[model samples]
Target: MSLAGNRATMQSGIGMIEVLVAIVIMVFAMFALISMQIVALRYQKTAHLRSMASQFSADLADRMRGNIRGAHDGAYNLSRQRYPALGDPAPSCPGPGSCTSQELAAKDIHEWRTGLGNAMVGGWGEIAGSVADGFTVKVYFLDMLAAADGATPVARNCQPTAADPVLHREVSCYAAVVSP
Candidate 1:
């Protein structure tokens, strides 16, 4: 071929190579964008769960403050082990002073527990200490990523000791302290 023709052919081949490189870089950039979106969605879900937990703790604290007598009597103390039976009938308190302090506490707890369970996945709760010495309210929910391993979810006690399941299980907890 002539000199001009040979140079034209080489230039066309180089242009094609550059186009291919640009296309490959664009594909990699698209994949990176998709990965970042997925990570942002996961973090958003986690933040939502944490917000729900904070609301639940605040709710129970308000309930305790409303029933200071029950709170001081230790009637509000609860644990995962003492879950109220779902079938048990709620106490009747249509009028003021219709129920005793303990009865009111029972009713409050049943309502609180039901609401917590309905709002979160695999949710559970506990109340420790008493109004006399201040109190702690804790709400727990399943850890979505950790539970993907297909193991049974367990409730965690924020107060941990040796052999505590909180160390091994897929659970998350939120706790708040309030003095009545």
Candidate 2:
């Protein structure tokens, strides 16, 4: 055979091998893109949850500010274990019948807790400290990704302590110190 024909024979399967290599590379790229998409979706959900917690915290702050007297009287103080029943006592002062500071506080807490429960999974709130020391409003909820074992790293990481209600669990906390 001529030298040119010999060269063509040697190069016969090179194009097929190159095409296979390209296909393999493309497959890997596609898998990487899919992985990135999954991570984006997870982060999006986390952001949405954090936003809800922030909104709830602000709402409670606004409520306390609206009733400064009750807030000052330590009426909004709630323990981490305390979960006000949903729709309890109907969070209302009623027409012309004014409610006391404590009553109003209870109403506000009930309404707020109800909203939290409705908006989140295993959602709860804790009002620690007092008006004199500045109240710390904390919202807690279960996030599968936010395990205390360091499965997922993010903001508001819930560290398990001897004082924690649930030790070594996937709990996410959003806290705000409200003077009102």
Candidate 3:
């Protein structure tokens, strides 16, 4: 073959190699992009789950605080007697100190739950009702640390039974029994 033709053929081969290399590089880049996207999605999901958990905790805490705050002398009851059993009494004032502090606390918690059941919607509400994956709110009379110790004096620790895993998340709220 002529030298020029040979050179031309060699050049064509080089061009093909270049094209293949470029394609390989592009493939690698696409793979990296996909990997990064997956990682980002996972992070977003984790953040969302954490945010939901925190929000649930805060909402419950706020309601508990409101109930306790409205109580006279920081002496409120925690029971499961009232409707909407999450823990808030109806707006009606306790007439002539009729309900004991403990009873009121229980009634309030019951009412609070009832309200929460009414308020929660969609998947969270469904999970809350299911015995397999639901959660519960417990009221502890002792401080946060003391309640875990199991030795501290507590007025009561209302927890769900073993059959109820829905309330499995360790949740507790403590308030000064005496008004500041």
For TM-score, candidate 1 versus 3, the one ahead is 1
lDDT of 2 by residue, 132-167 (tens): 788777777767766634653224353322125455
Deviation in angstroms for 38 in model 2? 0.7
Q: Kindly report which residue pairs in candidate 2 clash with one another.
A: none
Error of 2 at 33 (Å): 1.0
Question: Which candidate do you rate higher for lDDT, 2 or 3?
Answer: 2
Q: Give one clash count per candidate, in the order shown.
A: 0, 0, 31
What is the TM-score of candidate 3? 0.41
Q: Candidate 3 lDDT, tens digit per residue, 81-100? A: 32112333454436637865
Identify the runs in model 2 with alpha carbons over 4 angstroms from their true place: 1-14, 83-92, 148-168
Per-residue lDDT of 1-180 in model 1, one digit per residue for the tens?
Answer: 558766755643457778899999999999999999998887787678879988988888888889888998888986544322344567778877788888888888778877887888756666788776787777777667545556533434365321135454667666778777
Off by over 4 Å in 1: 1-14, 79-89, 146-157, 160-168
Lowest summed lDDT across 10 adjacent residues in model 1 is found at: 155-164
Query: After TM-score superposition, what is the CA distance of residue 48 in candidate 2 from its true location, in Å?
Result: 1.5
Best by TM-score: 2
Give each model a TM-score.
0.78, 0.79, 0.41
For all candidates in order, the CA lDDT equals 0.72, 0.72, 0.40
